[model samples]
Target: MQHESASAMAGHARQHYQETEQEHISRSQSGFPDFEKDMPSLVNRFSFSLKDNLSSYLGSKNPFYSNVDPQKDYVWLLDNTAYQNRIGRWKAEIVAAYFVKNSGKDLSEVVGYIADKIGMAKDEKVEETIEQRIQPLLDSILPAHAVTIDLQGVDVRLGPSGRDGISTDEIAIPGHGYKDDQVITSQAVKADATTMRTHFASPKGWAVLSDIDDTIKKTLTASPIGILKTTFADEPEPIRGMPELYKHIVQKLDSPPFFYLSASPYNLYPFLRDFRETYYPSGTMILRDASWMNLAGFLSNLTQGTEAYKVDRIEKVHTWFPKRKFICIGDSTQTDPESYGEIYRRHPKWIGAIFIRKVTGVAEMDESTKNDPERFKKAFDDVPRNVWHVFEDPNELYTKVDALVQTAT
Candidate 1:
C-alpha cells in the first residue's frame, strides 16, 4: 500500500514538473526580455532545457545562464562547516554566489503577491520595513562564471563561480594546529564578501542533524498562507522549548557539530542563518541549491521530494563523518520520518537517535497520516524501536537525549 502511494506521488510530482517547466518556458519566451537575449542560441536553449528538466526530475535545480553586469552585481558568501580529511588536514567547503539586485518594482510585485496570499490589508503596518522583511528575496542571480575568490589570510583562492552564479569549493586548510570547532572568518580579497567557516576535528563524537521549518523555527509548511505570512511578513518564531533543548544536547554531548538540514531553497540562507544564530547552535546549514524565479517555487521547495533530497544530503554527511554518531531532529510536517529512517537503515551505526516532532495545531496538515503510528512504524521498518521517537512536546526529549549521551559514553 505504501509503495503504491509513493509511486502515485512520484508520478504526480513528475506531471507537475512537466507542467511547471512548460509554464516557465512560456513565461521566458513571452515576458522575460533578458532571458531570450541571454539564451540566444537555440542549441544553448535546448541544452539548458535538457539540463533543467533532468535536474527537476532528480529533485534538484540547475543554474541557468544569465547576463550580469559586474558593476551592479554583488556576491553572497554562505557560511560552511569544515572537517579534517583522512590525510589529517583541515578542509572547508565554501559556497558563494553572484547576484544582481532586484529593482523596486520587482520587490513591490513580490510583496504584493505575499500580501495577497496572506490576505494582508494594504494599510497594515508590519513591525519592520518591507524592504528589511523581503531582503532575502531581492536577488536576481547572474552567472558570474569563472570568477575567482581569494580567501584572505588562508592562502586559498577559491575557483570560479559556475553558470548558476554560485561557487562551491573544497579546499584544504593550511594550518595544522587549529582547535576543534574553531571558527575561521574568511573575506573575499576583491569583492565585498565575508563568511564564517566552523572547523570540526576528526573525532568520533556525537553530532546533530536538525531540520529547520518546524523543528526549531516555526515555519508553517503545511499551510500555504501560513507559510507565506510567516516567511515574508512575520518575524521568525522558534518552537517553544526547542532552543533550550538544543542547548542541553550541545552541553550533554560536549558541543557536537550541528547541521541545519532543510528543503528550503538557498535564497533563504541569510534569513534562516540569522534565525539560527539568534536561537540555536552555530553549524553548517544544508539548504537546497535551486533558485526559483517565482513565488510559487518557494512553497514547492518546502514540499516536494523532500525525502529523497534529505536522504541524498545525509549520505554526503555520512561520507564526511562516518565515525561520528548523529542525532537527527525533524518534524512530522514533511518527510522527516521517511528520510531519517532511510538514512538510519543505510547507516545504522552512524545514527545514534532520531526525533520527529509530532506537529499539531496546523489545520492544513493531514493529521491522520502525519501523526499515525503505523506510518512511522512502516517508515522505520526493521530498525530498533527505541532508536526513533515521535513526540509532541520538545521537553519530552530532554531525558531521551541525555540517555543517548550516557549510553554513548
Candidate 2:
C-alpha cells in the first residue's frame, strides 16, 4: 500500500515537470496562451458553456468515427532487437520509446471535426499529448528492482544515450562464435533491460542505420495532404523493393543490427513501428516528441529541427557502437543528403556506405531538382564518390550493398 502511494505521487510529480518543461518550449516557440487563467475571460463562462453544449449535441448526432467506444490505452510498448558482445558488452543499444496517448476517444470524432471547423481542435489535441499527463513511476506492485515485460507495467525512465533514450542493462552471454541460435527469455523484465537479442549481430560489427520516411515507407512527405493521409488515415505503404534490399543487407551482414532513425513525431510511434515490423527486420526505433496540430502543424513538426535532429540521433547511435561500421539509408527528399554527407565528413572511418533515394512525386521536390541541380549536387560534393549513392529504384541498392559486402569480405 505504501509503495502504491509512492508510485502515484511520483506519477503526479513527473507529469507536472513534463507539463512545465513543455510549456516553456511552447512559450519559446509561440509565446504563452493569450490570456492567463486569473485574467477575465475573453468569451466569458456562459458563452464557453453554450459552445461546449452545442459541440456535444453535434457529436452525439453525427457519430463521425465508426467505432465510438474502443478500448483506451495508456501504455505503448515498442520492442526490437539489439546487439552486444557475448559477454554483455553491448555493441549497439536498442532504443525503444514508451509513450501514452490521451485515449483516442477523448472526444467524439464529430467533436474533432467541429473543433477543426472552428480552428481550435489542433490546440485541444496538443494539450492531450502523452507527456502532458502520464508520469514515469516505479511499478509499486513489484518489489524494488523488479520490472515488468509489459511497457506499462512499470514507470519507465530512459537513460542519457539518446536525447530521450533508456539505458540497457548488462545481460550475461558467454563468449561467442559460441553459437548463433542463442536467445534469452525472462518471465519478468529487469530494471534496465529492453527486449532484444544479442546473437544476431553481424560478424564484423557492421550495422545498417536507415531513415523511415521516403526511403523505406511512402510518406510523400513533400505533400502535407499526402503526409496526413499516409501517417494518420491510411495504413503505411512500403517503398517497393526496399524491404527486399534491407533484408538482403541483413543476410549479407550475417544479421547486422538495424537502427531506424526518423524525425517523425513520437505520437506516430506505434503506427510506424508496426510498418517496420511487417516489412523490415526488428531494430531500435528513435523518434522525437511533438504535438499534432491540424495538417499544416503536422507537416511543420516533421521538418522543424529535422536536419539537426538527424545529426544528433546519428551521433548517439555512433556512440553506441564506436567500433562498428555503419551503412546509412535515407532519402534525398529532405536534407538527408546534406546530413549524411556531413556525418561522413566527420566520421569517414566509421561509415561503410550511405544510400539516398532519389525521391520524386512531390511538386516541390520536382521543382527543386529541376531548378537547382547544384543544391543536391553540392550537398554531396564533400562526400566521397565511393561512399554514397543516390538511386530512385531499390534494385540499385541491392547491387550496391551486395558489392559493398563482397568487397569488404
lDDT of each: 0.68, 0.52
Backbone clash numbers for all candidates listed: 0, 2
lDDT score for candidate 2 against the true structure: 0.52
Name the top TM-score candidate.
1
lDDT of 1 by residue, 1-409 (tens): 1121232245446534634332344233333334223221111111122333333232212243233335665667777777877877777777776655543235655566567656774835752444466655555444433234444354554434444446677777666687766776766555545455555645578899999988999875455566667877788899999999999998998888899999887877778889999999998899875544345555556665577778889998887788889999998877888889989889998898999999888766667867889989988997798999999898899989889877662
Q: How accurate is candidate 1 locally (lDDT)?
A: 0.68
TM-score of each: 0.81, 0.62
Which runs of model 2 end up more than 4 angstroms from their true locations?
1-74, 80-88, 91-111, 114-203, 291-297, 364-366, 370-372, 407-409
Model 2: per-residue lDDT, tens digit, 1-409?
1121233234334433434232234333332222121221111101112232233223223222121111211223344443554444433332333222232222344234333433455665532432222122110001111123422233333221211112233333323443332444322233333244333453456788889988899876454334444554445689999888888988887677788888775546656767888999877777764322122333444645566678877997765566778898988766677778878888988888988888776653443552245755776777778888778888877777777766453
Summing lDDT over every window of 10 consecutive residues in candidate 2, give the lowest-scoring window. Answer: 137-146
